[model samples]
Target chain A: MFKLIESDAPQRRRICEIFVDGEPCQAMIGEPLAAALLKANCVPMRYTPVSGAPRAPLCMMGVCFECLVEVDGTPNVQACATPVREGMHVRLIHGARSIGQLGGAAQ
Target chain B: MSTFDVVVIGAGPSGITAALTAANRGLRTALIDEQLSPGGQIYRNVDAVDNGMQTILGPEYLHGRTLTTRLQHSTVTRIQGASVWQISDDLEIAYLQAGVSKTLSARHLILATGAMERPSPMPGWTLPGVMNAGAAQIMMKTAAAVPSGDVVLVGDGPLLLLVGKQLLDAGASIKGLIQTSPIAQAGKAMRHLPKALLAPGYLIKGLRLLTHLRAGRVPFFRTDEAVNILGSDRVRGVSFIHKGQRIELTVDTVLLHHGVIPNVQITRMLRLEHRWDVDQQTWKPCCDGHGRSSNPSITICGDGAGIAGALAAEASGAIAGLDACFALGNLSEGERQKLVRRPARAHRRQLRIRPFLDTLYRAPEWLSAPLDETVVCRCEEVTAGQIREMARLGCKGPNQTKFFSRSGMGPCQGRMCGLTVSSILAAENGVSIEETGYYRIRPPLKPIPLLALSQARVARSAGTERNSQPNEDPTHE
Candidate 1:
């Protein structure tokens, strides 16, 4: 079921604006959101509780949720696991600190 | 790299079987295994606390009992706890063990790394208490620890049902069993239900477990899906969306599982040709009746080929062992024929149950997982949305995805996400999952430390190099 279609590079370059941390990030049309953010080096996908360790991608295929980042104001979207949208907004979950910070309620 | 006539990676059923067969036939064998003991993940031995007996059954006890004892008697040189990283064309293996690097080489190689749980992701799946069912079983088998408090076992594979029984047996409270598929698929595959009734005792064990759960008035939700796992740190509860309605259940432990995908890291590393099996959600090494791979010098067997359960793995191992003997010129034509025929029948019998499993636990379309703003590659933190966009932009294949998005390029390599990513790629391109094969596996088979490996090779070749090296030979001049 695989078809190799030639896409017009100029036309494929449709521009879209997505917000990351209230900052507008320009992205190409038909590109995943994670790629744009990664290209921009906007990491620390999610924050841990105890040590407040920043965890990014662990298992790229969605098996592990280490790359989860908040999208559109919702917390815990697997950034590496999910695709990029034209105008998606992503936010980092900040309450937790480290593996040690796990016990306390979301501060 | 220290080369041998044959290298068998993994101490599991297939690797041990291949090593024993090859070595007994006088092919110099190097058996590289990951665990301290030979048994693979499924038959991992339990570490005892004191004098308390660890009761074992099913594949754990049966395969462990026989394979472990056989490995002890084999001529194979076993290297334990070796984590292979890559395999070269010369059959050289780079691996890490006990914080040391090492390398080994072989002319002919066999891989039997086996399988692991296929992690099916859902919303809130990242919650701390959400664990794969196999991981739960492994803990019980190896560490004798159960998920504390009320536990809910979800999914419909026979393993889930059996594990539920094991958990109950281990004195853990089972809140409910969530079966995602109907039981008729199981019943249909077992056409000779009355005769081989005892052979498929695992089904009965499942039924018994179901009956006990029912009789005990334990709640069970069938044809359901775990929509989300709720809790900030530890698992507080799980929301089951049944028939489009969300019902939150109070449970601290959420055991989630779908099925297993073949662990083909070592096999793929050898550059063995493979085929995608849509039913099992994994790639299997291409093998003929004799378990010989595309590389004539290499062979594969057991779950690495497919998930036919332990008995089938053993039967396949025996056949593979016999074939290895043939390759080594140790088997007479008659002996090989006799040994091979019996196991072929056993394999046929095992195949009967697979159709049922395939129909019953068909990876729910809902679980196909849509391209969202979620991360698809946890190692690189790549998102599915990114992968799809790349695919549209010409990152058409899993390999291309790896190159462009670093999707399958990570520490666990692609072990944890390869199957899911392949499925996603296939879906994106409107192709069957079969069309999108698994990510290529290269080996040491396990990770290894460089200094130790070099030291070992150096120690082994100390005397021989002086005699064989042309530069060191005074007579050559």
Candidate 2:
């Protein structure tokens, strides 16, 4: 579990609401989506296809693929690399994502 | 496709200094980084942080703001949130930004991708509540976040103590610090004390971090045996030997780290010659004192080149920047030599203490070579036993293990498991880690979506059309 601590100096950024697993969650505008999710206690960002083991962000620097979450219907987005956008739809990925999931278009 | 005179690939201390130096010399430089802001991992989000947070992060972190602020006023282009997926030997770069693919051709390239925490795999490390201590620090820096429940820090290195102190100062209810440093190596490390005394600031700072934790009266433990981050879905507790007797402590989060290694995936993808450093116990791309790699056009600096700390990275970057200016004909060779003297001296002073620190914090063997059932490859859920079995079955190295068990073939492309797998294979075969070569890293360093991959062609064609017919109506799109 994680909590967002108030800095001694007041924050000067905007806050926005994003959807996490179909639930409304408040997130800082332009901060990492993974940080927002972790603040909301939304761990286990992905399930492994091989053994179905639950995983969350290991290396927040994007070296580990453990935090691959489906963002706005696009599967396999690195949560740490992705910034929080207003009304962004983020769903935890389950196993190997099918190419046809959500509204994906072929290359 | 060419857009800039020089393109720097990261915005860490090194990249920031490099870009600033190049731009100051009249080179149209652009710095591409994956972070939301400049100040790669070491000083990440340094500009956004306020004065109150500054004191908590320490003077070293505040050092980044000077560079970031300087870059903000410079003519250099700072492209944020860019995932550089491909870089060619000829200096063609492709990166995905906001789901759009863009390409840049550069006369010179500086890769300062920086370092990543050496994954010291322990049992149940794949659990949800487990993470790199560096990750927690990033969250704290970028989001003002901190662990709310009971936290346990596992592993060795000064970073572990620094993180423990930072988290404790941030009000984390740290359970205990489980040290995995090979204390047996302290004698060897002591032999380097005279040389380390040349750089007194770092040694004192490391002790200060430890002293801070000790003053806080936080519980500290050292483990010689294997540690188990006991949990099913998330971290529930930790199981390890406290003092010849196995003990279990209930905990909510487990942060593991064993120092950091050069993030050489970019260099490896470029097919640069790399050597396994016996001291650092990791793969480092071969580069000169001035940060020139095998490819003449590409320059490497900062921790990405090796495991030199942030201070050394900046000095190395300054020296590299001077060399680049000389190469681009912006500075005379004599002038470049004259300018490089100060930063070169600073780089040497910063690196003088590395041997003492490296030997003191060498990660124990048990941290990497976990029990047979312990999961080593987080992506594929491959166990340590599977890797050893593959080695016994005559898998030459980490590459062959990929075909035999798919340990290193997942989305991460072996960043998390590559080093650990090498250690496992080396132990199983009784060969040196240098002989057990690393996985062959390929392009698309960061995985790109198929849509973005296709966008590369579209972006390139549009650029070609615009350049080929300059007189035609510019609004044809």
Candidate 3:
């Protein structure tokens, strides 16, 4: 319900289905994955790790990492930066993410 | 490593212009950007945005279309969707593209990486529906999306008014516009009117936008006090004092802005010398008029150089491009001067209104040094009080504060919280922002997969082995 404006501009029809938090959602091919999710009313994209606070896409540009979400098994991927693809799986990041053993203990 | 005569990082107004100028001057240029297409934030999705949206964005946005087209047609090697993670002092640029880490070298590197909205650290700013006004503009420009329900715009600056007007035209229901610019600043801003009139187009556009906002019947409040966003999980309402009266608006979305500062992550990471701009109250790289930074090979242009707006960025970019060409012996001194004369005049003219604007919309101190409870660093969840306490306890500077509180050590690499932390430290410690200093930037500038880095290293070594002379150590040099 947060989609205020409806564009009459020609848009590529929704040609792909992606999973958001294990739920299948229709998305337009080649659009930002965040836009697709926002259109689907996925407002709270992720929860901050420290405060457990809900956060959504702030700057769709890559500068503000508030849009950080897990995409296709990769944690902390920016939803706004990633283009939607067929069968893309996006999961809401709940808390602090470990960069696995390879990221080193300091990070 | 693939090397080019010039490597332009960014595809915005300045980067595109720089690349075009360099390539046209017979330099082997490579233009790199993180977006899938050209046209940085100001003209995002320029090629794809429809005519209706174009009208809403105005002529400034339309200008990018021509630039994008020209860059696309140019001989410059265009690299889109590249997240540049590192730039060594030796002009080695490393980036991640399609899950692959690659490195390239350039003789002359032009950084046109533009500005970002100043960090707004008011209470409840970290709420879900709370975001930068520029973010809302990006939503409209890139995704053809707008926030539904009651939206309250908070803060001040030219961008706030622009976004508010655009939102109104796009039919978004703005509950109220809370202008944080103090009423007294208007009188101060008037001092530069004669100089500002030199660029009449911008003045006219600004007046027109104001007229539209006034006609749209949106409630406007001018105040200097802090506006508190109310919500736990998401923005529910905004409460503030306006004209000696308290008012609260029920709103689901809150857009905040307080002007923009250069996105200096890459520049800082390169360890270039930077100076604090007292007027802008931000650290910008020390560069000559032609945009050449402390590093002779690296040139900083556009908003990345400083917030001189898009027109100045374009002009400065051309000047920088020509300077690089001259440095490379591509142009004679006389020819370079001739080429720079026009852009220099235009750049100066475009910059005429900035002093007045910067003075008029100077962010109130409270916005930067929010209340104790307000979160200062979103990544680390460091509160303003916590940062202040550390500063008082002899934290010294941003780098020291980082060790004490881990504020700037998050994924954002101090982008979101650097300014706030530094200013708060400066304020608390009774020192200038320069003395308080900034985060010691490190690389990889952005997060990159370890596997990709290893693969890139392997590829680099393989290429070196294949090309090295019998007695030469390719890795050493």
Candidate 4:
């Protein structure tokens, strides 16, 4: 009987220290960065802080800038698009003043 | 409602040839495309250092420079970044450019809109670090940006191999090339190999990539399947089942491709007769020996008819050009045929290689489809299980699946999951993929915000008010 065994390769796991409260947190290397942040149970990487549009990585093609976290003081860096590098500091940009009130895009 | 002797839609191989040929024959011609510059998706150019405009169009398409330069000086108007929203049976086109929508009419229309990248679905396809091979090429060739430093190339057919080499040249390290088909299947596909190798340089180019893979010690994994793309926010790695063993490789980017499909949304909207090509996985506008389409007012040539690559597209474009000239009373039938003879031969050769290429990459059915748990539309987090349930509940087609399961209804629309969902529907219903048809693409085709659309209208009106000479034809000398 040819039986398939469960391989040791981990399919989904997270790396820690992505960003929290608009500040850079140390992230773990060689793990899923998003999962680690979620495991740590941080409420949000970025928020509207006023209208409170809770945004996360969506459509992932860099097309939708949802999971944008300020990296190395650069605001609006796509967290899902940008790979974590060693010693890379990440910060979350939040606040109603920080995220200006932009209305629905004119269709 | 400005009328022209001929209108060539899409400035790709087919469109360029049609425009150049018709313009040279002294016909008032217009060439339209979506990019900011000439050369369609294939021969894209980035920055203009001098008037030269360092072009990155493929080797086969490099010869387009002569034709493009001639077109630059000709009476033909090259309109760039123009989105053709709708084409009517009466040869009316509604297009938008620089933020304004305008309607144009033509006596004769040639739809050389060319082919698009086939829809490929995976767990994290909609995620930020993933892109189609065409998009990757555009980013590298047009935008002068590499998606990632380390990339894993997947899928089969010529572009996967070719683009991997190109990415390497563009300063990206291809971790490996994972071919879905086994080596044995490749042997079967080899019978139709002569068609691809018919040209003087085609075989050499393919062989060059293989040689480079060997010489540079690049790793290639055949008979493998990428089970899941592991990442939460961005692409972190890919897990595959290679010959019954699971192996996961961590990488920053994943370049997904399954060859090319006909860019026929505009054709479909116009209600032109089209036939589904099984092997190439695309819809081609039905045309006769002289490239006359069902509309009679419209003609189609090149890969938009089918995936035969650039050379065939060039030949088909020429055929369409000659046919347009004949219809415009500029050339006799005999003269047209004589002019198109060489190109017809080239197109025939393109058709020949397709069977071999199809067999070689015949996507192991499983690659496009995964288990119930595997996510198809990563944007909406729609899983295969959810789609199957929706289909069971009478979601008959991709449109319905989109409506119910939100499979093809995302920010990317159905460009990424349309084919896969269609394939799944066909498989569930026990039908052919061709019968399923691709997704419906509407205006503002590249997903511009509604704000951008309104702004575009304002810009167009202002530009007209300024009354400056239209500089839309950047390809012009």
Candidate 5:
């Protein structure tokens, strides 16, 4: 698991609970979703569609879509680019996301 | 739909400077970026970063706050969290804002999109625990987070050394650093030392970072070998050769870096003339002294124009901004000439160390040109061997390789693997990278949702739309 060192210690950040794969994880408000997931030791954000190989945030920037995750039933969202919020729901992408799982539930 | 006299695509040092210069000069300017904050990646979360993080991230990063603070006081409109999906030649920009599509028109566009780490797709790079050194830098800059346990950084370039020092400062246990800068290349860099010494501060900083890494008890091995990250699904360790002897280290995470290159998605999509930069080993838009591309309406400054660090980008940004103002009739010929002198001089002065750096950490063919079983395109899962086979089949260029192997047709749109494929194909075809060429970039450049794209089409009102403005008519071309 990656270590988070008292992040943003000087600034009093609003901490909230977010659900990932139906499990509760503590997240800082407005922090990147990928960072929060990494801090929570939840790597392997997605599996490659071609080889089903597990992949995590490679660049932590938007360029490498290796950090693609499903948030609130929306598929292929970049966790590195998106911000965490209270009661946010995230799911790791297992290879190609079907339209059913995605459902485009959150616009 | 909103309109801007000048639309700056990136909010980094260069973009900010360009926006401020144009806005302060009475042109309507809007600076857009994907980050949640004002500063781009170099200064990610400048305002939110605590004092502790600031000390750990170092002074160069802290310097971003000054630019952002000045940006806050300026009249420039700062738009954050917007992923620009498309940029037309006519300066019609379409982007996704909070999951919805928004289109804006601009008289002039300045893209300070900045530089991205060169894609080093060695064996096991697609694994979960292996990432770029810049990613580690990003994690630290944004959240003060670091990989725990044994961490090994493998590659060459000033960024690798800088990240090693930063990770050590953040209290991360760096198990080792495997530098792949060839000894022969190091000898070549010696020739450029005199010219590089003109910018002594850069060399001094390099020395300081190396010293810090040494003081941290981190082992360093400069191997003229392509380092391999050995793992089934996650990084277990790294194995490489040193002096005809194989050396291996146990590690939890592997970070790779080999300098950075201009991010040319916008320029490529616009089809502005690009030349393969042999020194930096990447494609850069052919721009004038003021960063103006073949398309006079667009200007690319900063690393997006080329990898001329932050200070150089700031100067180039000023030049680009001043040029834009002059083009838009804000400054007379005499006024523009006088205003351009300082930034122009500063730009040249700041880039004095580039040749030394480019040669010292040139992109190693052995590292980037992967072989059988090594993945080239992450999205499509195309292997390097497959791409080589495509080249053997007489594929015309990178565009044909797309149909042959589906390498560049992934969701990432070839951002992660384009350069690697280019190198592999070039080597296989016995041609220079310049001759092999790069992937043909198109919109949506950043992978916007299909739903958003459809919605945007439905709500379209620009050049191609039904109620199009006469000035924005499709036949204007």
Candidate 6:
């Protein structure tokens, strides 16, 4: 797993726990959720809807949406753009996201 | 709605410099950016990057610290972490921040939106482990993390070499450095060496990077092309042709980069006239020597105007800022000219080595026109084959292809695939990429939730009576 280089600069680490695919993972408080996941060796953040192929964050700058994952029940959240918070819930997106109630007929 | 004399659309070096200049000229200025900090991508998190990483990023990045500090002290109002969605003809900007949609008006707009790594779409590029070299650098800059395991650097350009050297310096195992520039180009590239040496610092720095790589004994391959990425679910290996012989390297991570192209979404949305730069092989807004666009009210500076690197970007920003001041009657014509003299000369000098660099790292035509099976748009899963088929079936342009196959209609709004699609259409239709055109950018440039839009409208409506005349001329007073 990739870890940050130990720096002589004073460490301002903010420890927090986040749930990834139902597993509890430790993360920095304000670090990008995607970076934290990669540090934990979480490859294949999601599966492409078209081919059911695994994909991970390519551009951590949020230009590429390869790191899209469901965060706290919100679908299509860019993990690279979103920051990690305490008790944040992140779910690995599987193949072909469903549109949910937004696509359903009005009741 | 809040109004200002100038609204700089990005907080990078150019945008910050513009804002600082405008504010120093006593114009009400507003600077908006999507990142939480100022410094854009090149010097991202300049203030927060640890000293250890500082040594890795080099002095160019340290320059951002001074710009950021000046911006913080200036009178310009900074709205960080805001995504600008729409820009109107009358210089009105609609943006979303913290789930609140807001609109601001400016008499003049300076777009310093900067650049994105040119899309290198190849076989297996869509795999998980394949990423842009710039992306990897961003991770290192922002997160202080480097990719573990065997990482292979691919493609051409200064960034490829710089990142390879950085990763090796950081004690990461690199499998190889695959250069896509044909070996013969080196002889041609040297023809401009005398002119390039005029900017001795850049040439020396580049030479130093190359020397370091050689000293590290990093296996370098002058491959004719990066033909394919060999992987099933993730990047397992990469295949390229070196001297008419196929070679393969097994690796866990593959970082690719060709060069950078202007992020022209905002400028295109504003419908400003853009000219295709043949040497750079990208479409950039038509701006004058001082960064004034075809539309007098709008100006484009920095890499968004053209790829002239950071120093040129800052110089352009200063010129645009002074020009905007003169336009707003804040500075007299004589004073503006006198102020811009230094920056103008510096900007010209910074552009001295561009011809040499452009020739040395010209992206091969095949990289732009990827193999038919390679996926062009990752958002919509549109492939080169599908785009070509659409072109053959009388698809006039990218917009038509969008309807037929949904190529640029994804969350990225064609940022990732626009250039590739245009190149394919141009090649198939026997026209220049300029004639092929780009995706028609519309409102809501960044994704905003439905709830936010409604709430913003309601809040604005409530304040309409108090600040009703958002379009009122600020100079009239």
Superposition error at B309 for model 6 (Å): 0.8
Report the poorest 10 consecutive residues by lDDT, candidate 3 chain B: B457-466
What ranges in model 3 sit over 4 Å off?
A9-15, A97-107, B458-477
Once fitted onto the true fold, the runs of candidate 6 whose alpha carbons sit more than 4 angstroms away are: A99-107, B458-477
Per-prediction DockQ scores? 0.02, 0.70, 0.55, 0.05, 0.65, 0.60
What residue runs in model 5 are displaced by over 4 Å at the alpha carbon? Answer: A7-11, A98-107, B457-477
lDDT of 5 at B373: 82
lDDT by residue (tens digit), candidate 5, B65-105: 88999999998888889988876556778889998988888
Looking at model 5, give its docking quality level.
medium
Best candidate, lDDT: 2
Winner by DockQ between candidate 5 and candidate 4: 5
Lowest lDDT sum, 10 consecutive residues, model 1 chain A, at A1-10
lDDT of 3: 0.84
The lowest-lDDT stretch of 10 consecutive residues in candidate 1 chain B is B457-466
Among residues 3 or more apart in sequence or in different chains, the pairs in candidate 5 whose N, CA or C atoms overlap within 3 Å are none
Best by TM-score: 5
- For model 6, which pairs clash? none
Q: For each model, chain A TM-score?
A: 0.67, 0.85, 0.79, 0.53, 0.85, 0.85
Docking class for candidate 2? medium
Q: For residues B163-243, what per-residue lDDT tens digits would candidate 3 score against the true structure?
A: 999999988999888988767778988997888888748788888878899899988887678898898778889888887
Q: How far in Å is the alpha carbon of B364 misplaced in model 5?
A: 1.5
Kindly list the per-residue Cα lDDT of model 6 for residues B1-477, writing each as its tens digit.
Answer: 799999999989899998999999889999999888899998888887755688888887888999999988889999998988776556667788866888888898889999989888989998888889988888778778888878888888888889988888887788888888666667888998898989748888888999999899889887765468998877888888877788888898999998988998888877779988988999999988889988899888899999998888898899989989988888888998899999899888999999899889988878888888899999889999999999999986899999999899987889899999999999998888888899988767777877776665332221113355778542231
- TM-score per prediction, in order, is 0.73, 0.94, 0.94, 0.75, 0.95, 0.93
lDDT-superior candidate, 4 or 5: 5
The positional error of residue B319 in candidate 5, measured at the CA in angstroms, is 0.6
lDDT of 1 by residue, B1-477 (tens): 566777777777667766776777677788887666667766665222111214423444544657777778877788986666656554556666655767777766677777767766665555545566765665554433455568887776877876777676666777877766544556655654544444555556657867866776667786544356677655678777665677788886677777777777667665667887766656788899888899877777888888887777777776776776776567887989977898778776766666656666656665656436555565565666777787688655788888887777754567666766877778888877666666765433333334455554332221112355446532120
The DockQ assigned to candidate 2 is 0.70
By DockQ, is 1 or 3 better? 3
Tens digits of per-residue lDDT, candidate 2, B1-477, equal 657888999999999999999999999999999987999999988887644456678888888888988999999999998988877545778888988888887898888999999987777889999999999998888887889899999988888899899898888899899988877888989998999999848888888888899898888898897788887888899998888888788999999989999987888888778998888988999988789898888889999898989999899889878777877789997898889999999999998999998999987878668889988888888999999899989987999999888887889989989999998999999998878888888767878888778657432221122266547543232
